[model samples]
Target: MSLTGHLAASLHDRGLGGDQASAARALRAVHRAMAELRRGTPVLIRGGDHTLIIAAAETVSARGLSELGLAGIGPAVLLLAPVRAAAVLQRPVPQDAPGTEAGAVALRLPPALLDPAVLRSLADPTAERLLPAEPERVGAPALASAAIALAKLARLLPALVAAPAAEAASGRLDLLSVEAGHIAAYPDTAAGTLTRVAEARVPLEDAPEARLVAFRAADGGIEHLAILVGQPEQALAEGSVPLARIHSECFTGDLLGSLRCDCGPQLRGAIKRMAEDPSGGVLLYLAQEGRGIGLVNKLRAYALQDQGLDTLDANRALGYGADERNFWVAAEMLRAVGIGRVRLLTNNPDKLAGLAACGIGVEGREAHQFAANGVNDAYLQTKARRFGHLLT
Candidate 1:
């Protein structure tokens, strides 16, 4: 019951080839795929750069998707955005049509998905509104809405290119825009109607501290990440400048200390370190469980792992490859606290890569490993070997 089994089970439930399959099975397939990526379960995609995957995902609409078939359109529509990039020529796409890259990226959608109606629902405004919202939302209408959203984003890309300069000029959050190249505001920072810049960093005492404290993410979900702060001011220059234990939500390891993984100790260790450090680091416990995949699907992957699937195989078995987490909110928390450079504490190199790419720097990275036990040895080895963790 590796990830593939999970997916086959899900497809079985879809009535795609089912009389015995259940809808929950399909949901788990979607779940494992997303969480695998988010949690840094490593695997390569189509031999291209990771940004291509991210760029495609970014270009798609994030709203309203229940059916795996309907939501699958996002990645499909997203593949077009990177073609305009200069690097795309450096890494030319294969002889595939626009949406085909998305299909190749996430091979869940049928090849018939190349239909113009699917493309139109994604692009046509009227069809987008007509996109089925409830029961009828699974097929063409969902694809239609994705098509429209992607088209809208594409239309807005040029303007979006200039949005950073405008956003930083008028943020009340304690964020500094020193580097001209990366001056975008925090993803959660309020925009619109205001266009003023901060002269300098505003901390406690003379100036007011924004309520960034209230945004802590404490949860019982699947993925877990921790943000430890040795020095906050070096990274960002925002109001209240929060140091955080940024954990992705994980259901099994964090709560149950599942031997299949070591997420629990890392999370607790993050809290302990943050609490001890005294830099006022906020533990932003995330609700994006199983890397936003939810609980049941993780169990499904476990079942697959028992069936001798490697991590990536587990996800692919479930019908997805690795990685699906977004760091906008994590970036926001850093911005809210006025941190410019961070002394990040983690073993995962991709976290460093992703955060740095998103505009945060690892001025330093420290490794964190909980006590090793009999249960999670293979799991830790898998994470360390395949995903590139700095094992201790």
Candidate 2:
């Protein structure tokens, strides 16, 4: 079978088929739409029961808008962060306002402003904004699905904006079709069936006895790493449960030493702790940045955080659930390395639950915590309060 066909079959086996297929498909479409929007291309988004051409307000061009017949139909509505929304709309959006709960607001602009120059400003990436001018009436469930998809893409709260289905299908505007269901299945299956593509000894500043092993997904969507400290293989060979830490990749915090979260400390702390342990450990370095929202969206959430929203609320305001990460990849990595059980290191209970769900035995959890600084105090508090993270 071709690689695509093999991936499709694998996805189908991972519970993305049958009744759940629509939701999966919708998610894939959202991802595709996000990619297209990033390139300043408009995409056909099916929301409610209507299909609408949607693009990021920062990148949408006057020509792109005209191609979708948006200018001829009517004015476009801009969805944006409440602070920016209030600033742009020149109206006060009460904190207690109904839709303001998501920290986002939408404003309908005059159709006259759909020109290229105006659109370039509207689609500014630094400016938190979204344009939804056209709408086709669809069912509430469908609209909700589309909203969630859009939120995941923009990493902001959900907003209402879409192009008409008929206009989208007219072939003038470039429409990227999404096989969302198939794509959604890729992650789960990939986690279970990752192939080790490369491995090499890479000494870190603290953990000099570390070796990095890379695993590629069958569908080629994502890659995960297993950083072995000490002789994890030898430990496992002797029937010992190797210590392990499933650390999600954090560019801002891990790379830049940002104190907004405890990720950096936890990462280094885990490696240091493992280096000291006689059994050593394996740090499954996951590429699930920003709890799986990706780097740019995480920054968008940071902007929302600056506006007084907690970590969880910031993600929700951007149309995401509290945690979008999965631990199947970590579980699969452990299994691949011949370790069935582990002394998992983490403060989050979800990690335990996720690993357990994936059939990995968690022998025990080593309490992992870093001293709270002023910047991360609120963040730590929210993790404890909202997500039930084990932090004291």
Candidate 3:
């Protein structure tokens, strides 16, 4: 039988649906591959008619690169997102360029650029001094694009060192193998598998009556939190839309009280507002640090900010989108807790539209603006001007 038919038959033998089970298995493989990538270990990606061994450019060491080279048949290559490739090559790569996602600019890696430091400089735009090299742009294997995607999922820089794998390298080298198609399908597949796993009454300073619900995907990845304050479920039961806020977790701002942005104030202030509201509210604290580029990359962006690049531009320069937080996870969490309609507490118009697109009924919006401290005035202005936040 065909691959699809075989997968369906195996899932049926285990009493599971074909699509969901296949996606779950694929997500688990991708999850393990991400861990391997983060630890600087090379992973073998198997696509149709091709096999490649790839390592994260951010974490891979000289030893790891050498070992990857030893195991692979062809010359090693560096795969970079178009934006980052542009920065490294000092050329223009239009965002609207066709085939951007389908392929990446593969720079043939020379012996001098194989060091960890040089690889990092090529991946990171905020590097102090980029090493000079004659980079030849070539169309990388289709799997190279997915390899970069895997690095992004690991919260690393969207750059990877890849080489064509030796024959039967998966068995000979004992490398973790992941399908490129699975890496491509990871986001939606993981989001679709988000289930409310655990919850408890976690009282907060502002919201005394609060319960924290945790949602985890089937692959056992990061959990998104739902802070139900002042009986939001009850409000939903009574046909009153609860106040809702989708807060992306900011490590520096929320925990360390860093004044780089208004995240701490917004997080605390949103809870207080919900507690005071008679209709109650739910706060979805998504584990999307640095607007989904992860914490370390966020620090890199902070370094870029010191050089006068705004928040959005810094992220783009780092080969990431302006905001990579997926609100589909938020919508799934809300649905699990029986909340389909909400009066969202946010200044960003994107939140309103994001929920609406995910089939969540946004009854209205409540402004949850916080006054800018002296340090965050310019940052707040960037939010309003560049991110189109509705700040008054």
Q: Write the per-residue lDDT of candidate 2 for residues 227-346, one digit (tens) a residue.
A: 999997799779887799989899988899998999989999999999989899999999888987788778878987898878886775554557766676787888887778888998
Q: Which ten residues in a row have the lowest lDDT in candidate 3?
A: 1-10
* Model 1, span 176-286: residue lDDT tens: 112111111111111110111222322422112212243432111132222333444532344333344457767677776677777878776665665455354545555
Using lDDT, give the best candidate's number.
3
Top candidate when judged by TM-score against the true structure? 3
State the displacement of the C-alpha of residue 330, model 2, in Å, after optimal TM-score superposition.
2.2
* Per-residue error (Å), model 1, residue 333: 1.9
Q: Report the lDDT of model 3 for residue 173.
A: 67
Per-residue alpha-carbon lDDT of candidate 3 for residues 1-392, written as tens digits (9 for 90 to 100): 32233223333333223577787888889999999988888899888888889988878977778779877877787888776777676777754454344537677777787888777777788775554555776557557788878888899998888888875877876779998878866775677789888999998999889999999998998899999999888888887888999999999999999999999999999999999999999999999899889999999999999999889888878888678777778888999998999999999887887777777899999998888889989899999998888998
State the lDDT at 99 in candidate 2. 41
- Per-candidate TM equals 0.46, 0.73, 0.90
Instruction: Assess candidate 2 and give its TM-score to the true structure.
Output: 0.73
Cα lDDT, model 1, residue 140: 21
* lDDT score for candidate 3 against the true structure: 0.82
Worst 10 residues of 1 by lDDT: 156-165
In order, the Cα lDDT scores of the candidates are 0.38, 0.65, 0.82
